[model samples]
Target: MDNNYLIIRIDEQQNIELHYFWPSSMKIKYNYPTCITIHFDNLSSCFSLVSLCYCFNILSTSHKLYIGVEVFKAYLSVKFSQSYIQE
Candidate 1:
């Protein structure tokens, strides 16, 4: 599991946004919609923070407060691969 966490908030447009503090190496400026990945500092693995809420929803129907590490990792790999191809 990563020693990182996300901050969930709502934007002025009433959209639920998930903000992640990603390491510099993990951050990338991509043309992916619905998600924007950025660098916060030097820490953790390299992956996309896109569609995180969608990924979370797939694992929890009851809207659980947390997600499993392996599940999150797997989801990120798939998402990153898709975004990579698009970019």
Candidate 2:
């Protein structure tokens, strides 16, 4: 509810999942979609602008583009599976 954090998890298959966390309440909620899957010949395509922004804190989730940023101020945490790098 106040000061949330954005966490992105990318699996070996390039499956991305997003969730919001509130340390105060110790809760985590998934975004609209539980998971986002991208299929392409090259795995590099998974690091597109949109996904990069989501991973790098360049984009806001809760505000839904209303303020063009996080209203309560948020932090970003990105997790990648070991296979992600080996790919």
Candidate 3:
């Protein structure tokens, strides 16, 4: 496990949002809340965050968290039909 990595909360909808990334290079660690958009200071940091999350989720232990789809829907609570932009 990387000490310098971001945790992206996986929710339902089979959607993998580019939630955050890990930047071990920083003096202080960064944290992003679920459902909130993250703005990183560097370009590489952003890429590193996504790459790690994708790989980790794929290779990590076979837990119910990853296997359960209903859990994600309950956690994220995002409707597919809903748009981010306001009318």
What Cα-based lDDT does every candidate model obtain? 0.36, 0.37, 0.35
Q: In candidate 2, what are the lDDT values of residues 1-87, reduced to their tens digit?
A: 235554454545544444444345434463342233433232345345335544335434454453223211111112222322110
lDDT by residue for model 3 (12-86), tens = 443434333434464544444223222322334434553455434543343323323332332333434332221
- Give the C-alpha lDDT of model 3: 0.35
Candidate 3 has its poorest 10 consecutive residues by lDDT at 33-42
Off by over 4 Å in 2: 25-62, 66-87
Write down the worst ten-residue block by lDDT for model 2. Answer: 71-80
Clashing pairs in 3: 12-72, 21-49
Q: TM-score of every model?
A: 0.29, 0.29, 0.23
How would the candidate models be sorted by TM-score, starting from the highest? Answer: 1, 2, 3
Clash pairs, model 2 backbone? none
Between prediction 2 and prediction 3, the one with superior TM-score is 2
**lDDT, candidate 2, at 60:** 46
Which structure among the candidates has the greatest lDDT? 2
Taking the tens digit of each residue's C-alpha lDDT, what string does model 1 give over 1-87? 443345543334333334444334445585232333333221132233443444333433333335234334334544454211111
Give stretches of model 1 more than 4 Å off. 23-87
